[model samples]
Target: MSISNTTNFTNPSDFILLGIPGLETAHVWISIPFCAMYAIALLGNSAILFIVKKEPSLHEPMYYFLCMLAVTDLVLSTSVVPKALSIFWFNSRQIDFSACLTQMFFLHCFSVVEYGIFVAMAFDRYVAICHPLRHSTVLTNLVVAKIGLAVMLRSGVLVLPCVLLAQQWPYCRTNVIPHSYCEHMAVVNLACADTRASSYYGLSLIILVTAMDMVLIAVSYTQILRVIYSLPTKDARLKTFETCGSHIAVILIFYIPALFSFFTHRFGRNVPLHIHILMANVNLLVPPMLNPIIYGVRTRQIRDRLLRLITHRDT
Candidate 1:
């Protein structure tokens, strides 16, 4: 609430994040689990990076893609969670104007990158299961690196416009953002200028990216399932299915809550403000925390290597 107002109107005002509105009394208690989840997300993703690097046998296209995913999760979570904790724990809720835009840029950029990684992982599985013979040749190290670079570049390029547009708008309106983080639409809404173009552009990005990635992932898995069923024996089918379980689980974890939050924020008029804001923050954090657990539990090589590292086994 410490806003500086001079008769000068050219300078952009700082944004006041209300954290989770209507739950102000419980902010300290609420931050406990938030802090725990952020800790787990950092440690889990770091462990994925460590294990994938240390184990030579783990150096395959699949594991390399996983390392990329771990890195993205680290960047995404680190950008938002600390700021959220500051608001919840210390009630430090003011964010600078340029800093807010930077936060929004990284939030959406890494989010898009994460979705792109899911698509790549799906393709990796499809190549392995559908075209087992050509798996190595089809997804060479060079190809994987290219895919990672393309995803990152695409995310950055596409998200830049949104931040730039937001910056140019005259902030003739209030500068209070109710959400924990500077979500794109929420910040853009505070502008007094006509923002219909910005609003639709943001929605288009969400729909287009989410829909395109979902379709690609679905097609890849469809081919994978067909190949599995065509295998000679039930045991073979089950084994192949096991290979995909982690990817499927991770996809579900990442997408479901995310879509829900996005949709409710746009359409669900009856939903409470606190729930809407809280879910948006939770969706981003929960996926990063759970992704490593899902992979470590489902991917046998990683689990075994993790156990070995824990036990310090030489043999």
Candidate 2:
């Protein structure tokens, strides 16, 4: 059956994404790879969390931030992957308005929190590398807990209004979302009502929250670089830079495509839908999938622990 027939949406469900065209043609073929990726994301992120929680030696502010990142990755993958798989495999792409809104809300919420956590991680790295003697005192357990709470609250405050505003609009067209998941702009674009205000508000939030967080992260890393440069020994400088390399790589991986996707969707729709879809998937999936591997390989403790766990499990 056609999407319109299945959805029976007359009023234009503001949030029901129909997924991109051409997916229906390759549904069966795509399902295998998509499901495999989702399985890996779920299992991989969950294992990260389990390892961090079970290992007492990892009970520190740095690992705490890593745990938070793992949780965010799991939530992000969970929020988008299953529904996407269902759409591809079962030919059940019709998401209700409320469900779509809920998905969009959680997606944005976790995305914002992910950025906040990245900033926090940068700060942690800065302290550890630049002020090693004072790192413990500066980033105590209490302080880390407060920071995590603050990140959640900040994300909620920034994204809640945007989701509410987008939902209030009247959808006047087909409810089929052209992508696999319910993204904020995709939903807003479907509205028959004037979306200028909502668009502006969402853009403003993106600029304020994302831009500011990136600035703070940049400043922290700058200071870190200066300290690393001033070290007397080349080995000390190399070790310090090594500690931050994975974080820098992850940051670029996470932000560049996201910003590009956002801009392309908003300003470059003239670009092919396929390009947009590709970029969007990269922004959503690649970072989460790579984060664990990057951190696991770079951080000796996590690497050793992961190895030990795997070895013990195999034995």
Candidate 3:
């Protein structure tokens, strides 16, 4: 194969990213808010993780999943937000090919893991609500550990090949990505060679993974609702619904924006760049920021524990 056709960047003259238009003029303004967001996301998620770890009452499977979710959020935000803030602040938009690929890998990996965690959390709720008699058997400590491992393994293995395939594509001329983070589609679009295979593979994977998880979660919640309705006491039904209300809100917040962004990017090319960028960042940032808040507020036990911890620390 010709040197030009090869994916390997043997020389520095490989790819040039045409960064977002008008970045020089808008960098400073965007930087301020972006930096603030990063600070809040890091501090917020870290605080949740610390609270969950230090509190013995939070040793249950639900809180265990929340801890995992917090960790994933921290990883996700740490991977993308700092780089984004740097670009906004210093106008240093250049990212090495290997570094870009690594970013894409981790971003996708953690995103997949986050989806898996949502599924697991949904299952936890289902078991607790629908099968209270067997909740312990269904979601034991060992089972939670195994599920966590499966989430990591499933996402890691499934996304690794896609990242490798992406890195194999020759990026000849354009390397600039529009958004702050290394989105897979955006990165693939930079390749000089045909990216039809990579695009199709990615779409297939997204559809398969996301659709399956959504179906499972939906089914789990359906059974949970059924069980809730079967309860003879109105208070019992109301309490059960209250327990799941926050999670359902979180599910909508997390999935709706992501699905919109993904579909618009894939099929709705006519959408404006600013709109796309806005939706993409919202998908990444909002969920991380909202998740901990939702759990802390909706679950009285967690809220009470968080309050106690704060009060104790202050004392």
- Tens-digit per-residue lDDT, 192-299, candidate 1: 789888888888998999999999999999999989999999999999999999989988998999899988988898999999998998998899999999999989
**Candidate 3, which segments miss by more than 4 Å at Cα?**
1-24
Worst 10 residues of 1 by lDDT: 2-11
**Candidate 2 C-alpha lDDT tens digits along 63-162:** 8998899899888878988887787677677787888889999999999999999999999999998789999999999999999999999999989987
Per-candidate local distance difference test: 0.90, 0.83, 0.81
Query: TM-score for all predictions?
Result: 0.96, 0.93, 0.92
Order by TM-score, highest first: 1, 2, 3
Over 4 Å off in model 2, which ranges?
5-16
Candidate 3: the clashing residue pairs are 16-175, 17-175, 17-176, 18-176
Candidate 3: give its CA RMSD in angstroms.
Answer: 3.5
Please report the candidate that would top lDDT against the real structure.
1
Clash number for model 2?
A: 6
Query: Per-residue error at 282 for model 3, in Å?
Result: 1.9
**Local accuracy of candidate 3 as per-residue lDDT tens digits, 14-97:** 233323444547767866766677677777788778887888878899989988998998888788877777766665667777
